[model samples]
Target chain A: METIKNLLMGFSVLLTPENMLYSFGGVLIGQIVGILPGLGSVIAIAVLLPFTYSLDPIPALVAFCGIYYGSQFGGAISSILINAPGTESAVMTTVDGYPMAKKGQAGRALGTAAISSFTGGMAGSILVVLLAGPLVQMIISFAAPEYLALMIFAMACITGMAEKSSQAKSIVAICTGLALGTIGLDVSFGAPRMTFGSLALYEGISFIILAIGVFAMAEVMRNVSNAKHNGLQRIHAMEVVGRVGISLKDWKLIIPTHIRCTLVGFFIGVLPGVGAATATPLCYSLEKKIIGEDNAEWGKGEIRGVAAPESANNSCAMGALMPLLTLGVPGSSSAAIMLTAFMILGIQPGPLLFQNHPDILWALLASFFIGNVMLLVINLPLVRYCVKLVQVPTELLFMSVWILAIVGSYAVGLRVFDVGMICILSVLGVVYGICKIPLAPMLVAILLGDMIEYYLAATIVLCRRSFVNFMSRPIVLLFLVLAVLVIVLPMLRDRFKKNKVQSAVDIIDAPE
Target chain B: MKSRQDLLFEIKVSVFLLVFALVYVILTLVGIDTSGRFLQGNAGLDPTTFPYFIGIVFTGTAFYLLVKSIYQYRLNTEKENTDAAKGIGIPVVEKKPFPFPVKASLVPYIAFIVYIATLRLFGFILDSVLLSIVILFYLNQKNRMRNIIFAIVFPVFVFLLFNKVLDVRLPIGYIFGAKY
Candidate 1:
């Protein structure tokens, strides 16, 4: 009932014309950012951050939320239409999405992605209302130990998995972040470490500067350096296989896929380290298994495959947002940037964000609910019209990316140094990408580095850093065990799969 | 044996990174005095530790990468005769070169650096417009005049939104900030 009442208040807040315009502005920019390769939510958010300095916090937040969510929605368009994944989360969607688009069900494929995104988005918003406030409360009472444990859990999921076959790259990426996090003044110990007398090092590398630079700017570098271009092949191979109209036949098929994908997306989302990027692939594979290979088109333009990943990714994107809003433990790269945003606002996220700023929280949550509905209505009939967006002339599109990057960095502090800093990090991002290093771990390491050390220091004080006391604490012990399991269990599972494959191959090769 | 170049490069980068990490860890331990003025927010638990911790992790991960990449390279040589060597992922195998937008990406990449660097000199409004025009110019975009026009106009629009409307001050770069 309280949730209902708050949402009503939230609707009233979001319904105001100014806020609605903010939401519209966010979605509009988000779509463009999402579609463009080499740019991500952080860049867009950072770019937009400066613009929001004068607005009410809620409206500013609403706009930021729009950029993040809008980017996810827009990411699908490029991933499906082109083979390139616009957002890291959209990578999996490209696997099956592009294939379906290539098979001539482009419109249907796009429609399913848009509609499924709306469904999962709505479901995530509902979950946020029920779960966020309570979760925030639970978090507020948490001692340093609990926060440390949660950070450890988040680190485990990110560093331990990252889904890539190469564990080496993932580890390297994580270590890179850990190293960077340690730079700057060691305020706890009252020392400047690693600055080497350079004043820049004392301030420490800004996460957004690094994120935008490494992820967006570096990407620009790499893309430009690469002399080859894969022109959009689907346009030439155009074939609309799925029924043109989302007829009753189409609705019957997609609705079930939509619901299933939403459940899968949300469940995956609520967990640490797993998000839409993971959920999209998981949903796609699951949908294939459920539908059976013969009837289902798995890849090759199957509507279900397209819808499942799209819906799951969108759902997962929202699902990812929930934990960050309530608990402050960001679950994805974009969420990590959002954490940076909250810090800028001087608002410590976690459970207190809900209590201290219920109006803001409620307004932001309700905006998503309405924004998502707007997405559905806008996407179904209106997205076809949004094709005009693609026609906005490439110059404007890319120029806006640069503009936003400047706007966001400057907005954070009218500091000229950060703009310089963003470029340096972008170069590093390109290097990390080249090495096949998993970025998830790096972001996690950066986010958790402070948390881990803080908790460790506190524990040392509480238990006198005594070995026995430290080892004896139940939560600490549990975290230790969980941490070991996180690393070891995944290795064992992977090794088991490898061994099984080898044995099967040997058996097949043996003379009978 | 693992090929010399890959193993050597891996070891070299790892050692450089490790040394860097050690220096950081040592400095954090030394605790240079910051006097009371610098601290603002979460500095008590040690702002240095998290990122230094990041450095340590980087060093550790680099060591891991160096060792594993070397080990895999050796294994790949022995398995070279097998079909799995070329199939799917046979770690250490080189990927086919990226085939698209080969030259076009450089346009944006260089423009980014130029735009960022010139933020103060060109002023946010002028540099933004100039950088946008230069980047689009590289893309072989046919509409140069329009592109230049938008680049100049767009930042003015951004200036209006951020500075005038939102009341957030931006670096007028050198142009607007200088005493004329």
Candidate 2:
């Protein structure tokens, strides 16, 4: 009853004209960014963050939530029309979506994507509301050790989940981010750690600056280099013919896929470091495996293939919000940027946020449902117009991104130094990219680094510097053990796979 | 086995990380100010403790990377030799050179720096407009008229949105000396 009342109040808070307008604007911008290739929600949010500096927390946060999921809707349009995914999460959509377009069933493919995305998002939002309350209540009593252990688990999961070849590089990236986070004045003491006498460094590198540099500027540089090498190709979107509606038969086929993918996407998304990028592919594969290859032609315009990943992609985005809102741990790179946004707005998300700022939390949750509906409305009727965005020139897009990145970084502090730092970090980002180091772990580490240090210090103090006492707490011990398992299991599996491959190769050579 | 280029790149990255970790350690030890009056024993942690720990861990990880890469390189070389000895030749893949030279990638970074340095003198609108034009031209030399129009219009739109509507103050060029 209380949850229902809270949700009702949330809807009331979100229904205001101004808030509605902000939500619409955010969704619209998100859709535009989503339709454009080489631009993602992360960059859009980071670029638009400074603009939100003047707005109230509820509207700003609501707008960001809109953008996060709105892009999922937009991503499908490009994938269906041009065979190019507007966002990384939409990559799987292209397999069946583009083929459907080629077969002149673009409208059907798009309608399925939009509807599935809506269902997934709505389902995920409901799950978040139900899960967030219990999760927060459970963790509210957690102490410093437990929090520290949780952070360690999250970090370990991120590092473990990295590509096998890039695991070591991921660790280096995380360490570098942690080191960078330690630059400012210590929270415990007023002593500056590594400022090196620069007053600007006293506050440490701004999260906004780092985000723009790493995500947006670095991406622009990479895209430019690729364009220079490959030369720019004009985009030609496939025509959307016929009505954009699904038949009852198609709905029957899609409904089951949506339910399964939504559940899978939500659960996977709840885990730290896994987001839609992982969930989409996993859901697609799971759907394929279940249906069997003989039954369904997956890559050749199968509606279930279109339905599965779209559902997972949107739901995973919502699921990623669970950790961010409940545990104050960002589940993905986009969530990490949102964490920074929360901090900038003077709101710290976690258990205490639920108690102190239930209004904001519930309202934000309510906006997701509203945003998902808004996305469906926009995606269904205007998809033809949205597909036109793919026709936008790459040069103009890159230039605009560069402009926004520069202005946004400078607007945060009105500091040229911040702008300069964006360039430096962007160069560093390019280097990290060249070396195959995952940037998501680094970004997450930067956000979590200070908290990790603070919690570690608190844990040490609480335990009286006794390792045994620290390990005595069941929650802390369990999480720490889990963290260890998370790190070790992947490595063992990789080694086993490598050994199996080697043995097979040896057998082949011996026989020959 | 990894290709020769991959091995060399790995070695280079490892060396860079090792050097960075070492420098971080040195800076943490020597640079941080710990003599503040708030430095009491009761405080849970001194400033350097966390950074020092990170530095050490980073150095150790980088060292591991260096050793691992060297070991992988040696294994790759041995594999190549063995293949050659068996009268099997490894295919050499020709790498395509990037259309732009290495230095060309640095152009945007340099332009950004110049834009920032000149922002105070040239003001927000003029500098932004100029920067936008330069970037558009560098990105696509064609569409000169359209790009120029967009370059001017977009920055002005951003300026109005930020300055007039959002109530945020953007930098005004000293040369313009114009009040909004």
| B-chain TM-scores per prediction | 0.59, 0.89
Candidate 2 chain A: minimum summed lDDT over ten consecutive residues — where? A224-233
Candidate 2: stretches off by over 4 Å = A228-230, A499-512, B36-38, B96-101, B178-180
The reply for model 1, stretches above 4 Å from the true place, is A92-104, A187-190, A196-202, A227-245, A392-396, A471-473, B1-56, B78-122, B173-180
TM-score, model 2 to reference? 0.96
Best by lDDT: 2
- Candidate 1 local lDDT, A1-512, one digit each (tens): 98899999888877889999888888777876777666778777755665655667777788888888888787877777767777877776776778867767677777777877777788777877888777776667767666677777777777565664556566666666766676675535645656668886687777777666666555555544442253211222233344433556877888888889888888788767776767877888888888898996666667777678777877787888877887788887788877887776667777877778778888999999877876666666655555445445544555566666667666665677777777777666765565455676677667766567767677657666466876676766777688778778988898999999999999999999
- Model 1 achieves a DockQ score of 0.39
**Model 1: residue A61 alpha-carbon error in angstroms:** 1.4
**lDDT by residue for model 2 over A384-502, one digit each (tens)?**
88888788888778878887898899888888788888888888788888767788888999888889988988888899989999999999999889888888998899899999999
lDDT of each: 0.70, 0.87
TM-score of each: 0.86, 0.96
Which candidate should be chosen as best, given DockQ against the real structure? Answer: 2
